[model samples]
Target chain A: MSPAPTRRWWAAALAVTLVGLVAGAGVALSGRALLVVTTTRLPVALAVGGLALGAAVLGVGALRARRAAALAVALAGAEDAGRADERARHRRFLARLDHELKNPVTAIRAAAAGLPPGDDPAAVRAHATLDAQAGRLAHLVADLRKLAELETQPIEQEDVDVAQVVRDAVDDVCAQAAAGGRPAPAVRITLPTVPWPLPHVRGDVDLLYLAVVNLVGNAVKFSPPGTPVEVRGSDEDGAVVVEVADSGPGIPDDEVGVVFDELARGRDARGTPGSGLGLALVRVVAERHGGRATLRSRVGHGTVVRLLLPAGAAR
Target chain B: MRDPAHVLLVDDEQAILDGLAPFLERSGLRVSTAGDGAQALTAHAAQPADILVCDVLMPRLDGRSLVRRLRADGDWTPVVLLTQVGESYERSAALEEGADDYLNKPFDPQELLARVRAVLRRAVPGQPSLAAASTLVSGDLQVDRAARRVLLAGVPVALTPRASLLLDYLMTHPGELLTRERLLSALWGFESMVTTRAVDHRIAEIRRALGDDPAAPRFVETVPHAGYRFCGPVTRGVPTSGPRT
Candidate 1:
């Protein structure tokens, strides 16, 4: 029931009141001068009855409205409180898990180093594999905790040059690939400069750098030897958009939806050496900076990932 | 800070101490262990270490506070902080709080050793650390990286973004001959030594912007079909607090 009576109720009450008035008048007409005083008294009685009925209807509606409104507010408040508690618990749990894993990871690495030197080829492979796996595990744990921390952590606000970030990330990726004895993919950069130059992004520099590095690094990872990766930066309606495209095998259609989920790995990424949290971290950092990470792929053609941020949004 | 440097390693995790202490000692250095920051303080008071490689987020006291305490007491010992988080604000804050350098955890032990050695070697009584230097100065030319603007003879000079980055790369590796192939891979992300024309173009642009004649190079020197190098002297310093242009 609402706080106010419906129009139908008001209409019915008006009809009832009018009928009572007419009935009272009819009684007066039917009666003689000797009953005039009784007729007037009877009309007053009908009006008083009408007022009492209207008051009763309004009183019930007001009570029900109060109760319903209070219930809604309580439920909403409880839900918010529950969500906050859950997030806090999740963060603390991840931190503790990271802390606990670091010790064992370090110990495993040490134990791997102390593996006895031997002439068996299998033994040598085991030694290197153990050490590498331990290190990878350590990185995975750190990244898991970092993603959670980035969710609620306060980030810095600085004038960031995306071009500079892209240049640096590309440089680092190429250098790393060369060091690993793999053919580094050639990267072509296209950025807007004619239209008053590309506007500086108001964001955290390190976070932005992380996004570009992940984007370029992933592109390089899946690209074939001697293929070129393209990075295009442009201004869109006062917002900045960076697109990194690669000539690698595009992700399968069925596996595309979950690639950005935390610790998600696509079928095509089976043999890739990654922590499987790069895209997730990039998305989180994008959200934290009032932007978004998007992807489009054609399975056989390639994949294009875009990171868009609105200008002047330094939040 | 001394030969056969003494390293004080502090952490709440015994496994780290157990694993790293022996490795470090095997590398020919003295090591002392502390369970927490308080114990570290007592140990430091008893016998000062030449270098302190400690983890942040320790019990009893934390790494940043320990650094502050040491700095307050006029102890300028080189300190390297290790942490599990990679927050940018916290990274800058750690350096500003007087830490010589900080490394994120899950790092290679070899890398940690390299950092320790590098920090120790560069710990000149009052010079700024590597990460803290936001500006690079070469005779009559100043590049404020934080500001992303360059100055020549105290006057701001306008250069394209690519040229500016090239200048920065050259300035950072001053006097080191950077071949065209190397520059292309480092600056252009090229895989092979494929036609190094792009490198020569950018170098020419930067040279023109800086008013340097190829015959008599003041900033960038050509190596006659080999490569290029920034022959100017370079120094690291803190940037003036702003964008001056």
Candidate 2:
């Protein structure tokens, strides 16, 4: 099907033809002996033998070259596909950024246009709206920056107390809820009791704390008010595991895989106040610390997020 | 008539300081303003406010440092922190530095007012009325801290001192996740080398004494990987004569 293989075929045919002609010429030049051989058809037999030998050598070389060329094309195709995939990911990232930015900018613009030149209450209200939208935009940008940092920054490894980290996360979640005017959801923490020792994990404490906070906060955000969010810690298979479980509407099975993707939100979380970077950040932080973040959920039950970090030696 | 509770609002942003001051004043609290933590300290020294509402990030000094400085000087002025949204780490850090409470920025003025009032009530001396109830009653389980007794179905349960203390703490902070470390530090103090396992032993003992099932816990719920929580709705019960703190 390709030109190189076709050219090789043509060259093999030419070699066979040339070899047969030469053998025939040599037999003819031998005069009466050649004429006797030709009469007995022995000269034709030698010509056929020479053509067969020539075709075999050239055909082998052609086949090898054809195989090599096919391999080269396949390799190039794979490289092209990889490049295309990278490009598509970049495009998607930009599109998501644009989509996130557009909302607050549009709101700010609309509010600004509605602003009147007065110290009236309506003017103050508009100013507040503009300020709030600007804050939203700032928060989105900040989350994006933090996510970028998490991806690129080298993590600081130190022995961290898992129980202490969980406490800090719970405290933060409560504070955030109270700030948002929502009654603080009751967060219950269960630590592995004695016989089961509390395991120290090796990671950046601040980053790990942030990841836990994000998990707990997400659980709280998705759940209805008064539903208890539970955080539990244990060591399993040489890894320190912290699980944050929420009695919220669970993520659908089809949407579970992409929950760790940047800007990916569940259908049930449409009106929720989040930048959709929380889970992605958690996954990044866990992975950077030589650990992993995972989620388990059932639609009607609840969602449980597990953050596992490599267990460090007891300090 | 006593003076209205005074609040000192500190933030680097003039717009925020301006935006919040009037709303707080409208909520019936006397408000003072400071541009940053340093100014807040100076203002507090000049005339102490009933409570301090400070931003976490600001010029001259930050909210955490401000609270730390105030606390170091034995100034236990109930302080509330204002932090950026999603900065939960900051909120906890501020709390560790002795801040009474915190609110995330772009907050509803109403929430701020509520926190201000709540913190004032807690910080004010001789305000035992705002303290948690002395006795906790959940269904058949009754924990009376003043009496140092736990009763199930009106029958007294014999509990060791350690078990009694653990139960009292859990009952006092109903619905709160009390971690093993917290329990250890609270019960055994910082010098105790007792591992979290000891806390579990005490909890088990208390659970047994109370006849609480771990699998389907009625009163003490095990929040897997965190700690124990009193899951039942707690109510104030009439105190009986017993040991008093």
Candidate 3:
């Protein structure tokens, strides 16, 4: 890797060539030179002795280098295998947890859906609570499973139109918000036109879909009903940048740094219904696609979450 | 005047069976339950159910294999697989294996019931399931989806690639009201930022190629303030004889 080692190799090659020439000349000059003079001039015994010593030293050096190289490869392989095993164990755990939870959730949901609307107010409230909580619990399990799968799965790459992804995310957020018994946020999608269109980002469309949905969903969830959730898209320095801006209570300065962390929740997000893993998913998706997700928020003002990704050409 | 539709509900969990069986019965369906895929197969052998609702991850013979086995034996029963995993590959793989449709688990019973009803409505006796059918015929219009070719009145109709894709999606969905957002996502993945006009542009292209009238349309119909739907009845696979020009 270094020039010094290359230079050393060249020098060693020259030394070997010179030694070969000198040995050949000695054999040719044997009949011409006097035997006593030739003996006085560096004896054949000393030359053979030096050559044997050099060969032994070089052999030991080569053997040590080979052993070190093998050891490094083995350590790297073990580390990778250990990581893969850990991922598999995690997947199995999630699968078991999902199965164990899914059956009961389905049962509870069915029971609630089947419950006839009675005149009793308390029973109706209890039914509503049970149904809502069951749905939330199911959502939590799904989120956990997706996060685990994302860690182990290889991401797909295709030319993804950012405009389409943005629209899909907004629609998903609105539908989810409506399902949660809240007014759907009015989303204003802003993208370039006429001069330059939004660039396509080559990545897993589904993963990008997931990432954007989480971003806009989180923004809509934290914001009050009827407030605006604005999405902006543009091409900057050969990368596509999408920003979700929401008029909501912003995170505290101390909590801002950790918003993208796994299972991290800010003080402003305490009462919100979420899995607290959306931002982490966003960050991971962006990083995997050779991009990044960043946030800029002001207390009591608003928050802006930006997902930047390298632009990809036609697939 | 008609008999209640029969549904074969299969799951490994007993509690799931207890919870869903009665609910389905209450929904006016003649629900027969199976403990696992093997049991479902045996039950079907005894008396074939109108439709099968199977859980994908049963211990003895998984849903995919069950569907595969049934399909290999030349059975054309409509099967709807219920999967727990969220992988698109698994769902598509099941579809490719000749399953009619698949719904993710943890879904509402009402949703499952709706999907079952829809699949039943599409099911035709002695006909190949929708998944196995590559050609669709409706009167003079016949499209071979695998060949990506459209023929009207026994004559080839040239269509843009986008129009062809839109037609394929519409033909497959048939009566389903496909919104512009869904169409955009399906066709262009342009779900946001761009207006719904992009879908209209492609729909116009399709209508032009098919010689369909927006008013009293024979093939594609526009639903006011909603979406578009394929109006005519679609028979799965190619007709035995060519359509008369």
Candidate 4:
């Protein structure tokens, strides 16, 4: 029923037919010999039968060679198609990068042009606008660099304390607030106080720290002041887990799935400032540590983000 | 009313410092400026400001290191960080480093002023301390830690020692996602033979006492494979008479 076996059967049948024709000629010559015909006819019939047998074998060999050539062509075509797909993906990435960079650059240029040639408050405001736009552009570049590094760099795995990482991330956010001259949001870290020691996870400390910092920082950005942002750590399902919860406006139900996409921001985060690489980086860091990053949020209530990493050997 | 708080603003960029300095000054805060982290430290030493407003990334030192160094030295001056990279990771890192708050770059100046006031209000002297608070209230649920009792809508809810401890912990740390394993380790010592299932059972018991449905949990929401979170707009309440366990 299959095409390949059917073709083979047809080739075998053709060879049989050629053999049959030669045999028929031989039979006819034998009959003539018996009926007093000359011995020359018998020799001619035997020579024809030998030629036919050789031709049938050659035809079968040719059929097999053709099938092998077609198979090789098909395999080559599939490989070529895979390469094309990869190239297309690369092109798409480059195009997205170009588009992301252009927006901020254009804004910066416009702000620069608006700067007046005078010592006035308006000029100062214009300069500030330019500075902010330039900063935005710079941040985009930094995020891209981090993404590239995450993709290409080899992870240095070691025993890392999830609690310590959480503490350091909180510290980083506080420092940013102090440096920026903004009031730091109240961040509450809930660690087991009675337990003398905290559980450790296996991961690159620096990358994990960055990932946690991103989660907490996002909570602060979306939440209102006076409401506390909570960071907590615990062991769950044989893994060391850290969670950041905020009393901020949460992501919509529909948009929750896409928040992990590179450069994806929530629909409610339209006016908020971000490059949208934070969650993406968290996912990358978690996966690299043989873990995962997950989020749950209810609109207007709050959002909770968790980073779960494999538990390391006890120290 | 107390005098307007003195705020020291630190940033690497002259333009940012220049722009933000006048804005704070206009908002009626005594503002000082520093170029980098080292300079911010020196400036803080000479005459300490009520609050520090610093940029996260700078040439001589970063914001996190500066705050850490200050905190390590036992300086408790309230600190805030100004971040261009407004990721949650950076914000949490700042907080861990001893920053009181942070605002993303390109923020409204008025918003920054409001945050400064809010932090100062919380830092005011003789405030009710979270650690010392004996009664914790979230919605209609109340837990009296010292008395070891829980009340839902003014009705007494009997709980086991472990369940009471769990409830107290949850009430004290509202809005925190506490994992079942954490509950197990904390309530029962790290070496306790109890499984995570025990924690689940205890939670179920506590929820039943509070009349919270597991399917649509109001007090303790299950986080699937992760753990549980006490959803709360928690408030501290004055201790009241309750039957002790």
What is the docking quality class of candidate 3?
acceptable
Query: Considering only the true interface residues, what is the Cα RMSD of candidate 2 after superposition?
Result: 14.0
For every model shown, what is its TM-score relative to the native structure?
0.59, 0.40, 0.66, 0.38
- Lowest summed-lDDT stretch of 10 residues in model 1 chain B? B186-195
Candidate whose lDDT is highest = 3
lDDT of 3 by residue, A11-57 (tens): 89899999999987987778665344344446777888899999989
How would you order the candidates by TM-score, starting with the best?
3, 1, 2, 4
Query: Which residue runs does candidate 3 get wrong by more than 4 Å?
Result: A1-100, A114-119, A139-234, A245-248, A253-258, A261-264, A275-281, A284-289, A297-302, B84-92, B139-173, B176-229, B239-245
**What clash pairs does model 3 have?**
A164-B190, A164-B191, A167-B191, A167-B192
Better of 3 and 4 by TM-score: 3
Which is the leading candidate under TM-score? 3
TM-score of chain A of each: 0.70, 0.63, 0.59, 0.61
How high is the DockQ of candidate 4? 0.02
Worst 10 residues of 2 chain A by lDDT: A106-115
Candidate 1 lDDT over residue span B77-118, tens digit each: 888888632244553475456676655665557656766776
- On DockQ, the candidate that comes out on top is 3
Please state every model's RMSD to the true fold in angstroms.
Answer: 10.0, 17.2, 8.7, 19.9
lDDT string, candidate 4, A124-148, tens digits: 7777766666656644654554464
CA lDDT scores, all candidates in order = 0.75, 0.71, 0.76, 0.70
